[model samples]
Target: MERAGFWSRLWALLLDGLMITIPLNLIWFMYQGEWTNNITQGWAWDIVYAAYMTILPVIWNGYVIGKRVLTIQIRKEGDQPVGLLQMFIREIIGKLFLGIATFGIASIISAFMIAFREDKRAIHDKLARTYVKNRI
Candidate 1:
């Protein structure tokens, strides 16, 4: 299987942020009649979106909504399906916490790794022992 490109993966994530996260946050704002303190996170919809990202691929054969749209998939090494704990490590621990803890340096390194690595695996992918593959 071919690896997904960095640009495609970046675009897919942007699409998810725009198409899903933003809209859901907007709906929550409308219902609450007030903006959230953070606006982008620390809200119910953010948690829901995080859960969606972390959980959907495990059960949905590696495709989240944006990944599905972009024809890419997250999989473990050897092209096996990802699992719950691995997804949790990838999305929550490796990406979120480490990204935050490192002052975004890890995120920048991940971008480079995804762009430069032959397998297109990011730091989070390495941490979780997973990678994104191009389905097209």
Candidate 2:
């Protein structure tokens, strides 16, 4: 079967984010009544989201609940199961650039490149040595 492309993977991520946002926001509200009232609480929620994004992919064989629902899984370039270290690097370090303006620009370029690149790898995927593929 053909590999999944960058857009497909991005669509899956958007769906995943939508799935998690409600519960995460609710948890944040329980910790602090409003998002602006407590910086520490906001940071705490960020940590939780980070941990969820990072650890779930590793433990679930690269399919977080969203990806699983989308029938996609992350794997190494040669189709090996993704390891924890790779997941950490991918979900943490690779995605960290997303918060910075310059890095965001870089991300756009990287994403466009990934769309047409032969290996079908986004910047995070290249850095982490991973790919998202349709589950067999």
TM-score of each: 0.88, 0.79
Cα lDDT of all candidates, in order? 0.87, 0.75
RMSD of each: 2.1, 3.2
Model 2: per-residue Cα lDDT over 1-136, one tens digit each: 5667776777877877666677666677888786543432556656766787788887888888777877888897788888888887787777764535464876787678668987677777878998888775
Give candidate 1's TM-score.
0.88
Query: Candidate 2 clash total?
Result: 0
Which ten-residue region of model 1 has the weakest summed lDDT?
37-46
> Residue 112, candidate 1: how far off, in angstroms?
0.3
Question: lDDT (0-100) at residue 20 of candidate 2?
Answer: 65
Give stretches of model 1 more than 4 Å off. Answer: 34-38, 43-46
- lDDT for each residue of candidate 1 in 1-136, tens digit (9 for 90 to 100): 7999899999889887777757766786899987654656566655777788899999899988789999999998888999999999999999888988999999999999999999899999999999999887
Best by TM-score: 1
Task: Output the lDDT of residue 66, model 2.
Answer: 71
